[model samples]
Structures are given as C-alpha cells and as structure tokens.
Target: MAVQIKICGIREDRALEAVIEAKADFGGFIFHQSSPRNLTISEASRLTALAEDRIQRVGLMVNPNDDFLCELAAHASLDAVQLQGSESPERVGQIRELLGVRAWKAIAVASREDILRAEAYADTADFILFDAKTPPGALPGGMGLRFDWNLLKGLDVGLPWGLAGGLNADNVAEAIRLTRTPLVDVCSGTEAAPGIKDVDKIAAFCKAAREA
Candidate 1:
C-alpha cells in the first residue's frame, strides 16, 4: 500500500492546490500563535472550506485551552486535531472526548525510548506523529530537523503513526524505508523559505512519498 502523505503548515491557496493535485491525503493548519505558519481560525476555515472533502483537514495546536479548541473546531471544520505540546495522556483523552475529532498526538523522538513513550498515548489518539526532538528555545515541531531514523528500527506501536520533521523529496524515501511509517508529514521540507511553502516542492514531496 502507498504511504499516506500529509502536507503540513499550508497557508496559501496555491500550496493547497499543489497538495490536492498531488493527491495528498491530509492537509495541516497550524493554529499556534508562536509559529510563523500560524493561522487564525477564520483563515483556516476558509482554506478548509475550499478543500471540503478533497482531503482531511488537520488543525495543529500546542496546549490550547478549551475555548480556543472549541473555536477552532467550529470554524475550521477540522477532520483531526494534532496536539504538539506537553499535553499529558489524560488531556489528550479530554481533547478526544470533547472536540469530537480524531486526535493526532505528536511526540518528539530522539531515541528508541522516546518512541516507546509514544505508546502511552496510542490508546487515546487516532494517530501518533513522531517529530524531531527540538532543543530549548526552538519551535514546537516542523523545524526541518532530523532525528536518527535507525532509532525507530524494529519498533512496533499498535496505533497508526506518521514520520515527520526534515522530510523532503530527497530523503523521504529513505525515511520511509527506514521506519516504514504508514503516514508522512512534511512542513518546512516543502517550503521555499521558512513558513513559505513552495508549490513545486510540495508536489515533489507528495510524489516521492507516494512512490516510496
């Protein structure tokens, strides 16, 4: 089976079109205020409306409050919510129950131990996103930083998980081969500049992911 592709941090219509044209499975909207790729709920709603049924719309957030999450779900028509903060397993469960959307819990991975820790959220989350571990004073995720893929070797978490961070056309195939991840998430990797997505790069990343 072909690996699912999620082109993340999409801000422009052209980038959205590129993902659609490439037949990507998921589109991500960053709702965190800190990130350069951050999108207001209204903005994400407009973009999500355009992609209605064409792809799954994923809303990315840090440890958001209830009101923020409610507003996001109401406005964006999100198919899934990715919690990329220091949210605990119970909080993930609460988000799942109250939000009524699939939960994609993101865990930063630096080693096999990190991957093992992800299992704790597997029961509550619909999917687990493995992002590169960031040092202090860095962005939450999608910093285009890569981790050791060999660290994931022989790992078997029962839930569906995605490989993310520093994934692009050139190295996506290798990442896929190394981890055999069911889904791949690309953000800065497909961008021409920081938070500026390149249409061609998006297309290329999607194609490579599918072919892998």
Candidate 2:
C-alpha cells in the first residue's frame, strides 16, 4: 500500500492549501499552549472547517482536561485527537468515548521498552504514533530529532500506527523502507521556521511518501 502522510502544525491558509494540494492523508492542529504551533479553538475550527472533505483533521493536545476537550469538540470538526502527554490508558479510553472521535496516542521511543509500552493502549487508542523522545525541558515533539528507525523493524502493536519525528523529503522514503510504517507524519521537517510551513517542502515530502 502507498504510505499515508500527515503534515502537522498547520496554522495558515497557504499551509492548509499546500497540504490539500499535496494530498496528504491528514493535517494536524496543535492545541498546546507552550508550543509555537499552538492554535486557538476558533482558529482550529476555521481550519478544520476549511479542510472538511479534503483532508482528515487531527487535533494534537498535551494532557488536556475534560472541559477543554469538550470545548474543542464543540467547535472543531476533528477526525482524531492525538494525545502527546502522560495520559494513562484509562484516560485515553475516556477521551475516546467522550469525544466520539478516534483517539491517537503518541509514544516517545528511545528504547525497546518504550515501543513495547504501546501495547498498553491497544484497547483504547484507535492509532499509535511513534515519535522520538525529546530532551528534558524540551517541547514534547516537533523538535526535528529522530530515533534509530531500526527499533521499529517488524513492530506490531495490534493497533494502527504511524511514524513521526524529524521526517523530511530526503529521508522519508528510507524511513518507510526501514520501518515499513503505513503512515508518516511531518511537522518541523517541512517548515521554513518554527510553526511556519514551506509549501515546496510539503509537496516534496508527500511525493516521497507516496512513491515509497
């Protein structure tokens, strides 16, 4: 199957248009307050509405509360919610049930144990995202750092999963070849600066993943 692609951190019409033109499978909106890519509920709703029927929309949040999730759900049209913090399996399950949308858990992988830990979310999360673990006091993800792809070789977590962290046009094909990840996500990799996406880079990354 052709590798699916998700271009994350979209905050502008041009970026959203580029992702749609590139035909990426998903576009992500960051809802974390500290991140450069963070979006307001209003902003996310507008973007998500613009992307309706064109690309799947996902909201990325970090240890969000039930009230905030409910607020976001009332405003934006999201296909899934990506949990990028220390949410337990029960929390994940509750979020999935409460939102009535697919839930994705992002696992920060630096060692074999981290990858194995994904199995804990099999019953709750609809998808698992394997991303490189950032350093202490650093942002949770989108740091343009990558772990050893060999760690994912022959991985089977009994749930749909994707690969993320530091993927770009040049290395995406090789990343796919090594891990055979069905879906690949890019954030800073296709950016001109933090929270600024480059249209050409987005197109190139999509091409590389599809051709892989």
Candidate 3:
C-alpha cells in the first residue's frame, strides 16, 4: 500500500490548501497553548470547514480536560483527536467515546522501550504516532528532533501507526524505506519559520512521500 501523509500544526488557509492540494491524508490543528502553532477553536473550526470532504481534520491537544474536548467537538468537525500528553489507555478510551471521533496517541520514542509502550494503547486508540522525544522544558513535538529509525526495524505494535518528528522532503523517503511506516507526519520540517508553513516545502514533502 502507498504511504499516507499528515501535515501537522496547520493554522491558516494557505497552509491547509497546500495540504489538500498535496493530497496529504491528514491535516492537524494544534490546540495546545505553548506551541507556536496553537489555534483557537473558532479558527480551527473554520479551517476544518474548509477542509471538509477534502482532507481528514485532526485536532491535537496536550492533557486537555473534558470540558475543553467537549467544546472542541461541539464546534469543529474533526475526523480525529490526537492526545499528545500523558493520557492513560482508559482515559484515551473515555475521550474517544466522549468525542465520538477517532483517537490517536502520540508516543515519544527515545528508546526501544518507548516503542514497546505503544502496545498499551493498541486497544484504546485508533492510531499511534511515534515521535521523537524532546528535551526537558521544550514542546512535546514539532521541535524537529528525530530518534534512530533503526529502532522501528521489524517492529510491530498491533495497530495502525505513523512516524513523525524531523521529517522533511529531503529525508522522508529514507525514513519510509527504513521504517516502512504506513503513514508519515511532518510539522516544522515544512515551515519557513516556527508556525509558518511553506507551500513549496509541503508540496515537495508530499511528492517525496508519494514517490517513495
């Protein structure tokens, strides 16, 4: 099967249009306050509306509360909600049930044990995203750090999963060839600056993933 792609931390119309035009499978909206790409619910809703029927809209949250999730679900028509915090498997299940949307858990991979830990969410989450763990006091992701892809060689986590962290047009093909990840995700790799999505880079990344 062909590799699927997700362009994350999308905050504007041009970037989202680039994602759709590039035929990426998913477009992510960051809801966390610390990230430069964070978006208000209304902004995300508008972008989600524009992307309806064109691309899968995913909302990213970091240890969000029930009320926040409820508010987002009521307004944005998201295809999935990605939890990038320390949410437990049961909490993941509850959030999935409460939002009535696909649930994704992002695992920060610094070692083989981190990858194995993803199995814990296999039954609860609809998808697992393996991203490089950032340093202390930094954002959870989108910091452009990548772990050794060799760790994923010949691995299986019993559920659909994707690779993220530090992927760009230049290295995406190599990343895919090594990990054979069914899906690939990019964030700062396609940016002109923090939170600034570059259309040309987005196009090139998608082209590279497709050709791989």
**Would you list the C-alpha lDDT of every candidate in the order shown?**
0.89, 0.95, 0.95
Greater TM-score among 1 and 2 belongs to 2
49-150 per-residue lDDT for model 1 (tens digits): 999989998989999999988887777788889999999989999998988989999989888888998889877888899999999878888789989988
Stretches of model 1 off by over 4 angstroms after superposition: none
- At residue 42, what lDDT does model 1 achieve? 79
- Lowest summed lDDT across 10 adjacent residues in model 3 is found at 69-78
Q: Which ten-residue region of model 2 has the weakest summed lDDT?
A: 1-10
Kindly give the number of clashing pairs for every candidate.
0, 0, 0
* Candidate 2 C-alpha lDDT tens digits along 112-179: 99999999999999999999999988999999999999999999989999999999999999999999
Candidate 3 residue lDDT tens string, 30-104: 999999999998998899999999999899999899999889888889999999989999999999999999999
lDDT, model 1: 0.89
Query: TM-score per candidate, in order?
Result: 0.97, 0.99, 0.99
Candidates in order: C-alpha RMSD to true structure: 0.9, 0.6, 0.6
Q: Which structure is stronger by lDDT: 1 or 2?
A: 2
